[model samples]
Target: MKADYKNWMPKGMVTGTGCGTIASLVLFLILGVSPIVPEGSAKKVIGIVLLILTVIFCASTIWMYLMYRAFSYNGKRQMSKQIIEGVASYVSIPDGGKGLDVGCGSGALTIACAKKNPGASFTGIDRWGKEYASFSKKLCESNSEAEGVSNTSFMQGDACKLPFEDETFDAVTSNYVYHNIPSSDRQAILLETLRTLKKGGTFVIHDIMSKVKYGDMQAFVQKLKNMGYDDVKLIDTTSGMFMNKWESTWMGLSGSAILLGRK
Candidate 1:
């Protein structure tokens, strides 16, 4: 079984960054050559300013390229895939239990978990939003089949309102998804996911846990503990042992974290 998962970072991101850098450079060149600037201190200052802007954008474009390379690379060097597999390793589904993957982009995490826990059947759901138009239920199914995973299925569904009964899944997983949702109640989305988890069910949800996006995640974890969740922990995957500082900075995953617990 080969692992063929599309990266979470879109190719357009790199293209856009590169285009911005090019545009800035072109503007700088035009400013340098054109007769718009008078021959004085002002012209030198303007040239210096344009040069600085070009340098900043050029550096930004390079950083974006590095990020794209990190994700698109195959093999062990692919940090995003490694992180997904790392999160999947934390999941423990009982034999023949049903597992659910929320916002299973490209079915990477879902298929990875299914392969790890062959005894468990996995179902992945996503809205296949236009931002990620390449990712569809059919692509997910095909990716699972390509990875030789048979105990997995894919469906279209919304994350804010999952189409499943409460306590229906023995395990649930999601990665880098919730923050993308255009909603103010991010914690509610997490609770909605937890609602589908059966008693003793395990979950490993990874996403950017910036305090701005998910207010006081430590408090949130404590709230889970208060609710009787066992072994609940909020792991800082971005700067912790899973991902290094440079990787996080280059990939713009500085606030990535995993919330794991058993219901």
Candidate 2:
């Protein structure tokens, strides 16, 4: 069965755009009324300020709308899905081996991997937070059923502290999730994710890895090398190949990168 992959953009993520559009239009209309005010007065200055604000908000609305279209179009085009799949391709999961998808939002990445590796079983975990109200374990299960993926399951869990025991999964993956976590110890979360993998297991973790958010990722990669990790590399996803810089910056996808390695 072909998977009817749902749009990955969460409702809350687009609320700002909607609000900006409405606010800009409303302000523009109100200012068009030309409220009674003396010429060259403070009120005129206020009007100019409001007009400037309207322009800024209007521009924001347009930019955000384009971003929404990009995300939706990419979803339909399977661009991001392919990117995730590309990252997963580096890993070699044994047939019928267990795999885990951390923070599997709406089960898209999990389902993709499950479809790619039919011989493997996959477990997806997410908190189902209110911010992404449309995503729940039920929705994930339904999507898997629609995709005809029988070897996959969904559960509630945290990325920072996975509920599974050490070396429980032969492979692990996540995408665009870690940065959302409001923690100073982002690297620690990555380490925690690796802890769930069996020795020599594979992992592909993708996220916005701007230096501001993830300090010294190269150093972190070196540390992994020191720990005997093999083929550890960081691939930038925001340049020309996957997504251009403009789109990435507008969609908050800038500095996106995938960290691939074997334990």
Q: Which model scores highest in lDDT? A: 1
lDDT of each: 0.86, 0.80
Candidate 1, 103-204: lDDT as tens digits: 997898999899999999999999998888778888888888888889999998899999999999999999999999988779999999999999999989
Q: How accurate is candidate 2 locally (lDDT)?
A: 0.80
In candidate 2, what are the lDDT values of residues 87-202, reduced to their tens digit?
Answer: 66755577979999998878888887888888999999999888677788988888899878898999999888899999999899998898989988799999999999998899
What are the TM-scores, per candidate, against the unseen true structure? 0.86, 0.86
Model 1: residue 156 alpha-carbon error in angstroms: 1.6
What is the Å distance of residue 212 in model 2 from its true position? 0.6
What would the TM-score be for candidate 1 when compared with the true structure? 0.86
Pairs with steric clashes in candidate 1: none
